[model samples]
Target: MTDTVLEIKNLEASYGSVQALRGVSLSIQEGTIATILGANGAGKTTILKCISGIVDPRKGSIHYLGRAIGGKRADLIVRMGIAHVPEGRQVFPLLSVRENLWLGAYTRTSRVEALEDLEAVYRYFPILKDREKQEAGKLSGGQQQMLAIGRAMMARPSVLLMDEPSLGLSPKLTEEIFTIIRRINRDWGTTILLVEQNASIALQTASHGYVLESGRIVMEGPCEKLFQDEGVQEFYLGQKEETGVERRRWKKTRKWA
Candidate 1:
């Protein structure tokens, strides 16, 4: 049986007057990929922020490896083996690609281990190695996304929190990025909590899924079931199921034409 690596219970967070997460609870088993599906302003990112200590929760518990980590310092959280790749691929533009990656290892105590991990990141993204000395801002969107993931990997995290990794990229590039994500999980046995707007890809990539709406978890299940759900089909996948009456009407209208 797999162990629960990360767990969140009754997670509540806010941004001043606005309540972001409302009693959110979820758990991820080790070596598995879980996904959070939601629309804009659905409090998905807030959950990540709370876990990573970027935003303090009003009330709740976040446990990683059986240790309570909610509201801990952000850097401390990273040192505890949870790494977050925020949305928008926030790589330092003026910094060299190598420099940006090196910053991820600041939490580590061993220089030699960090150096080895840096080389591993280069192996994961050879393009980054080719441009190690180049300014990060000079790279394209997909390259920057790779840089972001690679930088996060430099920490050798046990749990990777990825937010909208496919944001602002071509279809092909999105596929490529997800391929790397799968590779990372399979090779490193890293647990992943992915928050993605692209429902089709998210459902395909993650084994378990949770749907969020207006700061609450509305549905939770295996991705296979969620993919076939009528509401999910209509709302997230943009593919609505045709009722018998609707199908008959469509056939009648087609006959007239």
Candidate 2:
């Protein structure tokens, strides 16, 4: 197996006349977490969409496991070993949790394989197991997000693309979600490319990081080192220019059920 999981060269994507990604290129190594941090409209989600084959890039190439995957259909990319957990945690509201999870592996070769995938998901999130027959719409936001991730896992993706998995969750639930993400990468060796608004935890958890502003990469480096950077402090770390590290931790309450 190759150490390099994903590579993009001079990638360009646009929505009509408005360009979102402008000649952006990056690499993700196997079994590592790569995070892209940017404000809204900075083309973070657009990049993932292009990688997952939902959006066609106007220029450049995307290589996954050493094969060109750009411009393919979304389902084709899913079968090619990339699973996407979109920003909204867009689970099927009317369906039961189990049914929604089942939909994730509709292209699996056999029922036995799908069952095994279900077992893997249950192991990662026992909470979903308890709510198997419950309506997905009735679940809390955090539970729904967990279901989204579990559904993605059913695809058995080599690379997981997550967009704003922390959105609309309390600080406590956010922490829990990020913890599970880190555990997933550590235990399963799943290469994850994450885009998050919560830069504090996102930067802390990722192995490598890229800072995007207005669709351009301003800085890129390892997470721990970037944690101490002045730009990361002023922007991501959520500190004032004059304020030193207060050694304060984000308060996480009891919320993940």
Per-residue alpha-carbon lDDT of candidate 2 for residues 1-257, written as tens digits (9 for 90 to 100):
53989999888999999999998889999999999998899899999999999899999999998999999998889998899999999999999999999999876788898899899889888989999999999999999999999999888888999999999999999999999999889888899999998999899889899988777777889998888876677667777555444643365221210
Candidate 1 lDDT over residue span 1-257, tens digit each: 99999999999999999999999999999999999999999999999999999999999999999999999999999999999999999999999999999998879889999999898889889999999999999999999999999999989999999999999999999999999999999999999999999999999999999999888898999999999887787678987456675443333221111
TM-score between model 2 and native? 0.92
The numbered model that scores best in lDDT is: 1
Q: What is the C-alpha RMSD of each candidate to the true structure, in Å?
A: 5.0, 6.7
Residue 193 Cα positional deviation in candidate 1, in Å, after optimal superposition: 0.6
Question: Clash pairs of candidate 1?
Answer: none
lDDT, model 2, position 246: 67
lDDT of 2 at 210: 90
Could you tell me the lDDT of residue 203 within candidate 2?
91
Over 4 Å off, model 2: 243-257
| Candidate 2: residue 224 lDDT (0-100) | 87
